[model samples]
Target: MAPRSAVLLATRNVLYVSIAGDLIVAAIKVGAAAYTGGSAMWSEAVHSLVDSSNSILLLYGVHRAKRTPDQEHPFGYGREIYFWSFVVAVQVFALGAGVALVEGVTHVLHPTPIAFAEVNYIVLGLSALFDGATWLIALRGFRRGAGDSDLFQAMRASKDPPSFMVVFEDSAALIGLVIALVGSYLSIRLDLPILDGVASILISLVLALTAVFLARETKGLLIGESADPAIVMSLLRIAREMEGVAHANGILTVHLAPRQIAVALSLEFSDELQTPALEIKVSELEQRLRALHPEVIAVFVKPQTALGYAEAVERRRGKTRQIVFHTPSPPGPA
Candidate 1:
């Protein structure tokens, strides 16, 4: 199978597992909340339901992002994943956090005694088991790409949403479960039902923070974060090694999708090379680049003199810090 197809399959599988687990957990949580009249349990139910919906949206985003490039969108619809990811963040903040917060406040004001706190304990424990399993699945997928980095670093470096998003959701769910368990235990032990509502508020806070963080990361991608700096440097190195190439000026890149990148390279070719030779050199360079990095979907090459390349850089001066090779002096008399 193709690399992109494999990526889609893996992502879809993760989403499917999460959606199934959350639906089953949510159903049980709702029943427990209704039976026990526990605010935290109710909040957890909402959280699980929201998680299932978010995973579905992510699955859809993955599919939409797979659309083939056309005239209107020459780079394809890869950024669709980022856009939908942002929308998921909004839903978490608005629907998930908002509902939990409101429920928490109402419960605190009413201060009703929780019934059968033991039921909440059972439900939370089971939910944790389910959520923990799914979390491990997502983490394993993320770790495949993360190398030696920690989970937090991996999330920030990850270009794909479903990979890290599920991690974030399941992490919050697990933490929220612990808070519910503690709150349920304390509320019954201390005869303070308001503690249950406070626990719900904490869960809401966790969800809110997760949403904010997810939004910031997805926003960077939506605004077109460049591919890894390493990838950029490697592409320049490849172009510099070409036989007809005099100087590899620099490379420009943007991630069209997690695995899809569009690259533009500037090169100074040897003066004696005619049009036919230059075309062959360009084709050879592109083939080499794609062979080494299959993720680079398109490469745009520009033929420029050293002076022209310098002038182009000068025009864009101060826009952002740039890493570029010093222009080489013209070749000595042959």
Candidate 2:
């Protein structure tokens, strides 16, 4: 696996490129929309502007998240990235989707003939080239981070929001660009300007869906999600194999940041070890874990018997099943 610093540098580079591209694209799109009076082009301008702003916010979040740990907030501001990412999702929905929807609806109600058709075509083609380039950059970074996993699985398994957020936004922009191209063509060819408005609405729907997906993903990260199951299992195995540990009942791991993990292990040490010896064993375990996994920033060892841990796990499982079973069936027949 590539070093975390290398991954972060790559992510920052992609975001910088995206911001520059979006600024250029937005300016061209707005100019085209003004000259052509095309609703779809106007919506595209809004999309680019929103994406640019999101890129800026994400950069700011990365800066804030890197602040050193302090007394007030011991875990650092690592989740700041997730918070800003969630904000980006909201903006995409409210400004990008909501504005496009409203503008499209108005245009449909009172259709406007498009002028300067060639200008829109030229601008959109250029925008597609720029957006495509940025999309590829983001895609390459994501693929490197994803390693062996497929795209969908990589997305689901990814902990880094900045890396994935750009990919999602750029993908949406590319699709919206295609939609605008089609809508403009149909409006001019069919002599039905309302198709331009319809195209705007379709673009808005795309933005809305992207926003929703981004929100859901970012929310999980913001609320505290576990590290990978493979990592957790490995930690457990290491603990069990140690000379002083009788059992490794359970392991809990959470991502404090994309590159930082906090691990808490439930361990039952050998009966022969006294308090001082137990402390020594705990120190040794922590050192070994850190040496093996540099991302693990904190290690918390909780002494618990095998029976107690088993009971706790069973109780949690039972509660989970109860919740699932009692989840109100969707308005069943009375």
User: Top model by lDDT, which number?
Assistant: 2
lDDT of 2: 0.92
lDDT of 2 by residue, 1-334 (tens): 5686777778889999999999999999998998899999999999999999999999999889989999997988888999999999999999999999998999999999889899989999999999999999999989987988788778878999989989999999999999999999999999999999999999999999999999999999989999998888888888999998988999889998898899999899988999999999999999889888888989999889987787777887884322323666599688
lDDT of every model, 2 decimals: 0.91, 0.92
Off by over 4 Å in 1: 317-334
Decoy 1 TM-score against native: 0.93
What TM-score does structure 2 among the candidates reach?
Answer: 0.93
The TM-scores of all predictions, comma-separated, are: 0.93, 0.93
Runs in model 2 deviating more than 4 A are: 314-334
Reference-based lDDT, residue 288, model 1:
98
Q: Looking at model 2, which ten-residue stretch has the lowest summed lDDT?
A: 319-328
